[model samples]
Target: MSSSNSQKEILTLIRDVSTEKSQGERRVVNLKRQIEELQSELESVNAELEDAKRLKECTEQDLKGCEVELAMNESSIQTLEGRIALLQGEVSTIGSDLEALKVSEDICFVAGGFRFMCMLIKCLCFEIAWTCWFINLCEHAFRMKNGLCDDFIGKMFDLNAMIRKFHQSVDSASYEAFSSKAVLQNVHTENAHTKQVEEGKKDLERELAQIISDTEKMEHEFLLEQNLHKQVRSSP
Candidate 1:
């Protein structure tokens, strides 16, 4: 009975040892699987980190480019503003010059008109003198041919008076025409000069408008770029 009891105890010990060994092997296998899963996760995390690094580099490059573009836009805006100011000053100068030119033209026109009127009056006087001399000669010839009579003499005197009256009227009409023509020409020249000045002013306005439009466009682009830069800086 003592030997049987010892054998039974030995067998129970053996079975316990085998069961513990199996459990230990199962635990080792579980640890290996967990290690493999951890390795895969680590690899995935490393890949994600690489992608993030690349994204950061790209974002930095884009920010730098935006900064450069913004600077250029600012420079362009400044240049355009300067141009607008210069054009405005030039316009003012042009206006002053035009006013001075108009004054000079008016002075010149008055002087020229006076000289022309004097020349016309002198020509009329010369023509009247020639006509009077011709009429006197013809009257003398008629008296010599018809034997100087009172009736003929009276008729000749009446004719001489009528001729003198006609010549006076002609001289008055010619003086009026000369004055009117000079005034008309002066007005026409002034109007033409004004038209030219207006056209030049319009051209300057158009150029200024174009510059302003370009400046506005650049400002808008700069604002958008600035906003983008801010967003990039604030990004996580």
Candidate 2:
């Protein structure tokens, strides 16, 4: 009677141990499935993160290109402005020289007096030579004022056109810079970074860790029950 009771007790303990082991295995399987699901979600988030990074790179490139173009346009505009100033200075100098030549021509005519008359009467050839030389000087000064002055005006027109072109380029570059800034701002505003996704991933990781811990605890409990079953069977 005692042996039969002992055998019954051993059998009951073994059954209980097996049942717990089976339940623990099931829990482990479920935990593994949960982990796989979490990993899949993480992969999807990572893909989205990669796309956002690529878009940011492209926007940065565009912004840098626009900035370089703006710098070049600004430098060109400054150079044109300097050239215009130099040209204006040259024109002013030319005007002053023309004015002085005119004053000299007038003074030559004002030198008419009895002494001049006597000299002309005494030396007609000499007076004629002096008069012709003076006329030639006046004519040369007039040619320089007319011909070269027209050339300067033409150059000034060319400079003005260049200045206009520079201004147009600056305007275009400014527009491009503005457009690029808008694009960059939009990109940032869209918030295509990984902050939110990282939070989700962290949540999944914690859940997976908890599941694994619970599964391990279950396994430990199952092992303890198995040991208890063996001890019962070996009892005297």
**Which candidate gets the maximum lDDT versus the true structure?**
1
Q: Per-residue error at 21 for model 2, in Å? A: 2.7
TM-score of candidate 2 versus the correct structure, residues matched by position: 0.33
Quantify all predictions' global Cα lDDT against the true fold.
0.67, 0.57
Best by TM-score: 1
lDDT of 1 by residue, 1-236 (tens): 99999999999999999999999999999999999999999999999999999999999998788778767766765665676566667656666655565544343344444545665686678678868876886777765755656666687688678768766866774565456445545575566445544554465566656656665665666566566656655765
Measured with C-alpha atoms, the lDDT of residue 207 in candidate 1 is 64
Q: What TM-score would you give candidate 1 relative to the actual structure?
A: 0.48
**Residue 92 deviation, candidate 1, in Å?**
1.6
> Each model's number of backbone clashes?
0, 0
Per-residue CA lDDT of model 2 for 64-163, tens digit only, reads 8766765665565555556545655555564555455343422222222222444435455644665676577557656785657666567557755765
TM-score, every prediction: 0.48, 0.33
Candidate 2 backbone overlaps, count: 0
lDDT of 1 at 107: 38
